[model samples]
Target: MAAALDIKGLKVSYGNIQALRGVDLTVEEGEIVTLIGANGAGKSTLMNTVAGLVRTREGAIHHYEEDITGMDTRELVKRGIILAPEGRQIFPDLSVKDNLLMGGYLRSDKENDETMKTVFELFPILEERQNQMGLTLSGGEQQMLAIGRALMAGPKLLLLDEPSLGLAPIIVSNLFKLIKRIRDMGVTILLVEQNARIALKTADRAYVLESGRIVAADRADVLLKSDLIEKSYLGKS
Candidate 1:
């Protein structure tokens, strides 16, 4: 069977600067995979390239055996691949519920309502604040809304970028748990995080990216205990 998401020798550039240099990745169905590294490691670039937000300078991105290298973000979402970007990108003026509905922009099917029900179950706070504008929510709440919105689309694969960024440690912990719960629900995930410990802990598999290249890839548990974190992940070193 084909992997949920696959990238072969990918490379991306901006003007004359190369943001990703021959990067590669894969996430099997139902697995939570993470790419961990310090800032400027090309994690976001890879995510955007795969999500169809940025054009790839080189390489092919395949989703379920189908080539989707240069597909647009809207089309990718319709195909069951959705990305909740680095910063919470919810529309500040829209009601919490509306933001989620927009995530289902490509769907004409009534299953979207079911997906919204699941999102509410996953983040009860979002349900409570359903009528409130996105900007009024706290940073943590906004992040939840972003994830919930993505969930609203009933994605087969989720591309998450720094979901823990700027949130309190307690909230971050909860977010990580939610990620695990989502994976258990049968959605494959490609997570990019600045918080390696939590990211690796929640993920089934982990990869380390540096200057647009992959330096390590392994089962998550092994990565947590490895020398790579001690030396590379500044905080633990």
Candidate 2:
């Protein structure tokens, strides 16, 4: 089967400062593919490029075999390509439920209802505090809301940027479980995370970005056992 998402020979430039150099990546249907690297590794830049928030300077990105290299973010969302940006880009004043509804803005069908139900099942706390203001939730709850909102779109490919940021270790662990559950339900994911250990352990496959280039790519477990990983992100034992 074709990949849910495919990025080939991707090169990105931010006014002469190249962010991605000949990057090639794929997310198989229902797989969790994590991009792990240190700061300035261009992981976030890769996500933005895939989402069409940043146009590609080279290479092509395809979703379900359709080229979406330079499409609008709204159009991509309509096609079930959703990105839950880093930092939980939720409206502080809006209620959590309302913010989730915003994610379904393009949907007029009962599909979103099913999606919301799944999201609630994944994070019951979100359902419990449905009417709470987004700003009122703790960092973990806010991150849950962010994932819930993205789930609202019922995306075939979910692009997540640092879902575990600023949360307790326990929360991060539980959150990764929910992510796996989503994958089990047949949603493909392309995650960019700063937490190397958790990401490499959870994802089936992994890529390591460094200074705007892909320095490593392999099965997650392979990366976990690599000396390069210990030298770069994980300290040596």
Candidate 3:
């Protein structure tokens, strides 16, 4: 079977600085794959490149065996590759429902309503605050709104960048639970997270990035026990 997402020899740069260097990775269908790295390690660059937000200097990205490298963001969305970007990026002026609706703008009203029902099921809090403006929600609530909005797009593959950023520990825990639920619901996930321990625990597979290259790839559980991973990312001596 074709992998849900695949990248080969991926390279990205910003003017004089290269963000990703010959990165190769794959996420099988219905799997949760996490990319863990420190600050400026090109995790977000990989996510953005996959989502078509950043142009690649060299590499190929494929979705279900189809070449989609450098595709337009809207085209990628239409193909069921959706990105819930970093920082939640919710529209402060829009109501919770409106923010979600914006995510489904590509679909018909009927389709959006149907997808919204699923999103509400995954995030009941969003249903409770459907009429509230985005800025009124707490950090955790905003994060839920962001993921909920992405679900509103009926994603086949979800690219989540730093979903746990700025959330309390309990909320991060809950968020990972929801992420697992999302994977169970058959959405392939490519996650970029700074919280290595939690991310490794949640993912089926893990990739460690340093200075724009993958230094290690393994099962999440294995990486969690790795001494190098423990010392560098997991804060274990």
Candidate 4:
């Protein structure tokens, strides 16, 4: 089977600064692949490039077998490549339902109502506060809104950037569980997370990025047990 997403020799830069350097990564269908790195390590840059929010300096990006390099965000979303960006970029003024509806703006399908129901099922709190303004929700709720909004697009491959950034520990735990549930629902995931320990525990495969390059790639469990990983990212001595 073809991989859900394939990227080869990907290079990205911003004027004088290089963000990603010859990055090669793939996310197979129905699997959770996590990318872990410190701040400014090009993790977000990779995500943006795949989502067509950032232009690449060189290399190729493909979804399934089709070349999607430089494709616009709307085109990518229509093709089931949806991004729930970092910082939970939900529209503050819109109601929760409206925010979700915005995610499906490109769809003319009749099943949008059904998709909204599915998102409500996945996040019961969203159902309870469907009429509430996006800015009124708590941090965790806003994050849920972000992911639910992405699901509203009927994603085949979900690109999640830092889903656990500022939540309490218990909330983060629950969020990872929900992420696993999402994977079980058959959506392939490409995650970029700063919380390496939890990310490795939740993901099936992992990649380590440092200074804009991939330094290690392995099964998530393997990386979790690695001394180097433990020492550097996991905060273990």
Provide TM-scores for the models. 0.97, 0.96, 0.98, 0.98
Cα lDDT of model 2 by residue, 116-225, tens digit: 88888889998999999999999999999999999998888999999999999999999998899888888899989999999998999999998877888999999999
- Estimate candidate 3's RMSD in Å: 0.9
lDDT by residue for model 1 (76-187), tens: 8888898999998999999999999988877765877888889999999999999999999999999999999888887899999999999999999999999999988988
- The global C-alpha lDDT for each of the candidates, from Candidate 1 onward, is 0.90, 0.90, 0.95, 0.95
Candidate 4 vs. true structure, TM-score: 0.98
Ranking by TM-score: 3, 4, 1, 2
lDDT of 3 by residue, 114-148 (tens): 98999999899999999999999999999999999
Against the hidden true structure, what lDDT does model 3 obtain? 0.95
Q: Enumerate residue pairs that collide in model 2.
A: none
Give the Å error, residue 73, model 2.
Answer: 1.2
The count of residue-pair clashes in candidate 1 stands at: 0
